[model samples]
Target: MSEPFSLLMAVYRGDHPVHFQKAFTSSVAGQTRRPDQVVLVQDGPVSPGLEGAIEHALADSPAPVLHHRIERNVGLADALAQGLRLSDHDIVARMDADDISLPERFAAQLPAIEGGLDLVGTGMLEFLDDDGSIVGRRVPRTGQAEIERYARFHDPFSHPTVVYRRSAVEHAGGYRPLGLMEDYWLFARMIHAGARVGNLAEPLVMYRVGDGAYARRGGRAQWRSELALQRAFRRIGFTTRGQYLRNVAVRGGYRFVPEPVRKAAYRRFIARGERARRSTRIAR
Candidate 1:
């Protein structure tokens, strides 16, 4: 039998009640293999409607829910680190506040962990609206070597689709406050620390793409974060000076480009193996 796992998620006042409810239901109540427990961290204050939504969704959860509240917003990395500690199970699965995890999301991931992988993640489809039609697909390299190679350039795993061992993650120093690149930074450290990792080729999460998503990928703040990431990667010898310079030109340069150009580059390279845009309507 697969080991028990905790489903971890975080929510702030910015999260919409309706979207949170959907995310909660699909990732927990609607899953074929339900989690052993739910660890929810409220990053900050939430509205009454959102509180109501959380209460209703907890009612539908298959497993008991463990809750945490941060008096102030501490960002995703810090909030998630707290939830990770609160999780009783060694195996932990991550879910975004607005993404829809397919029913079989953990069905494959958990067993792969049992099979010895320290971390495993799956591909995801991006949706623009709540209508369920997929706008794009992001599939990372599936093989072990492919993942190791890809990590040098981009994030090798889809964050929301990740299921990982707590010990492996903690050994890598857990999540740090790394601006928007927290997930990327953590995965890089895990790889460098010799943690076994892999990816599922099949898409298991419907990631909600919000407005200004491309623009958000650029701007001064993003550039700063990208610089910090490249520096950190180089300092740890995870990346060579040559690789670091190249990333600054390619990935770092991605931060200041115009939104239209950034969007083009993202779909062309970052999306990886995307067959154009898949408009297939995903069903529950």
Candidate 2:
């Protein structure tokens, strides 16, 4: 028999009606090798209609769904931690309720895990509409050393697009609440601990960006959060310039540049930066 891969999903009231169910269903239905078990932690009581949505979605799934319902909301990191604790497979992966996974996502990641990478993340496409339509692609550069180097400056791996070895996450003490920077905190710990991380450089998920409970906060609040992340990055050794670039990427880059050029430019700049790092490494 083949080994089982555990997919841990954290769902909450933040998920819009039917959004999480669609994501969950898509994950299972689209996978090349179905996960051994899917552990979903419902962060809190969602809308009354949500249960029906989940039930209808899971009824037809190929994999078994293990649902954990929490009475109160404890934020994202805590919810993820609880879900991770419930995962009992060699491999672990994350999925957001509002996102859609490509069929080959797990297939692409399994090789990375088997290749000895502690965490394997893939590129993502963003959807502006509620349905599974791609608006823009978030392409991440591949390779372990390059991923680490880029992570020092910015979050090279999108959170929802990652599949990780369970051991590495345990080594990092699981996820922690850091407001808007929780994923950043965990990823940094994984990198600093010498965990072998890599990116697939392919869009394996459709992430629904700038929506849900957090969407109403407007640009100024987001700017403040970015500033907070910049401050947090300082504590972790990211240069002031890197922090500034991240700010620009989130605040200015997305808003100003047209979709056609922005992502292409982002890819080019990231590739250029990685090459520059390689040069520095050889020089040293």
Candidate 3:
């Protein structure tokens, strides 16, 4: 086994029990290099079935487990913050309650840390369910240059595939409760703070995006949240004035579009981002 590390996850009542069970099995119980401790935060009260599932998964876990229950729903960012604090290891891996991590996920991510990276992430494949019909594949920027350049307008890492040094993240302010863009915000701070980062351009996690995901991508509230995030990025010099305007014009407007339009644009954006990453890699 590799050096001891912790796996962190948060589950809420909204998540299905079956999906959570499979996620725990595929990401924790079946890992080639399992975590030394699995720390899960119950973001809020969950359904009885989901509660039972959590208990069952822990009972069958390969490593020791810490299950923390919150009195009320605190959302993912805050919940993950609590979980991160509960971790016992310096290195921590992240998993979602609904994603299926490959058996070799940690096996692949840990070596990147060995190479001096403080944080490492990989690409992911999006599927509708465990039936395994993949609907989308996301590719991440492999070089630091590409990652920095791309972050002005796009997410450089697939959130679920990230394995990071807890100390490095804590130095960068840990996980803040940013609305809608928590992961991106944390990554921007980490990059700006000069944290060493790397990415594997290969998919290691299977992200579950069920029906109506595109439709749920937009609303008046979502636009407001995104607007706030952009303003914060601008205030912190994470984005140039022109980049900020472009982001507002592009990502901001994306919130009000119809479902069909959002769905088409979403796929195109993914493809364009992947192509851009490839070009940047070649240039490097």
- Output the better candidate (1/2) by lDDT: 1
Candidate 1 local lDDT, 1-284, one digit each (tens): 66889999999998999899989999888899999999999998899999899888878778899979899999999999999999999999999889999999889788899999999999888998646677888876776887898799888998999999999999999999987999999999999999999988789999998888888899889999999999999999999899999998998887888899888877887354754223222321
Tens digits of per-residue lDDT for model 2, 59-165: 87788888888899988899888888888886888888888888888887887788788888887777776455655666675677777776765787789988888
Report how far residue 177 has shifted in candidate 3, in Å. Answer: 1.2
The parts of candidate 1 lying over 4 Å away from their true place are: 270-272, 275-284
lDDT of each: 0.89, 0.75, 0.89
**lDDT, candidate 3, 6-123, per-residue tens:** 9998999999999999889998878888888999899989999999999999899888999999999989999999999999998999999998999889999998886789999998
lDDT of 2 at 31: 84
Clashes of each: 0, 0, 0
Can you give the TM-score per candidate against the true fold? 0.94, 0.79, 0.94
Q: What are the root-mean-square deviations of the candidates from the true structure over C-alphas? A: 4.0, 5.4, 2.0
